[model samples]
Target: MNSLAALLDWYATLTPASLDRIAQFYAADAHFRDPFNDVHGVPAIATVFRHMFAHTEAPRFEIAERIEQGEQAFVTWTFHFGLRGRAYAVAGGSHLRFGADGRVIMHRDYWDAAEELWQQLPVLGPPVRWLRKRFRAA
Candidate 1:
């Protein structure tokens, strides 16, 4: 299968036990950045996944859309998990640049932490919603 196909499959089926296989999709010096993390290298990337598993319960990703052109691909996905005894689903997308060997060299995730994450919290949700309304264009 093609690298993008394989990557989508990997993410869809990702589990804490399978994190060890992250190296297969990322180059040794890969750079990965997301709303909450900016890290380089495969080991550091693994740490991010590890932290995810440590913090959330049954965190999994479902790929919603994919667009590929040459060595670059963009994917939209939904991340589902439980935190603080509550279930949450965060919608996000990622831009991936592949190396000559088909390993990901750069992976940047796009997500709004304020709207997608903090807004899900009980105390912060009200303030965030109020602020969004206050700043919204007329």
Candidate 2:
């Protein structure tokens, strides 16, 4: 299977137990960045998902779209999880580049924390919504 196919399969079915396979999918010195994390190497990258599994309830990724060209690809997905008994779906996308070895060398995720996370909080939601509406074009 191709790297993108294998990577997406791994991610779509990711579990804490499957995390050890990180090395197979990413380069030894791979870089991973997201709204809340910026880490390098297999161990550090694994820790990010470890923290995710520990802190979130039933966290999962559902791939919505994928585009590949040469050694790079971009995939759009929705991260689903529950916090404080509330379920949230965060729409995000990652830009990935593969090394010559076919392992991902860089993974950068793009998403708006303010709109996707902060605005989903019960207490913070109201104010955030207000601020967005106040500045939004009608």
Candidate 3:
């Protein structure tokens, strides 16, 4: 398989134990960003994954689609996990730019934080939903 395909497959199957292999897919100076994090370098990336594992149970990814062109690729995915003993899923996508060596240099994830996360929380869910409805366009 090609490098991009391999990388996507690896990510879809990533686990806390496989985090040590992060360096193989991301460059030393890679940059990663999502709804809540903006970090650089492989070790920092690993730390993000570690934090995910620590806070959630059985976190896993399912890649729904991938589009690649030259050194850039976009992957749509769904993340599944258990938070506070309750299962939750968030649908998102990643925009990745690879270096000449095929290691990811920039990775940015796109997702709706309010709908996917904040609106699912026990204390914040109601208020967030109400606020959304109050200001939503008709």
- Where is model 3 more than 4 Å wrong at Cα? none
When summed lDDT is taken over every stretch of 10 residues in candidate 2, the lowest stretch is 1-10
Q: Report the C-alpha lDDT of model 1 over 1-138, residue by residue, as the tens digit.
A: 239999889999998888889999999999999988999999999999999999998899999999999999999999999998999999999999999999999999999998899889999999998998899998
- What's the TM-score of each model vs. the native? 0.96, 0.96, 0.96
Worst 10 residues of 1 by lDDT: 1-10
Model 2 residue pairs with clashes: none
Q: How does each model score on lDDT? A: 0.93, 0.94, 0.92
How well does candidate 1 score on lDDT at residue 116?
A: 92
* Candidate 1 whole-model C-alpha lDDT, 0 to 1: 0.93
RMSD of each: 1.2, 1.2, 1.3
Evaluation by lDDT, superior candidate among 1 and 2? 2
Candidate 3 clashes between residue pairs 3 or more apart in a chain or in different chains: none
Tens-place lDDT per residue, model 3, 19-115, is 8899999999999999999999999999999999999999999999989888999999999999989898999999999998989999999999999
**Model 2, CA-based lDDT:** 0.94
Ranking by lDDT: 2, 1, 3
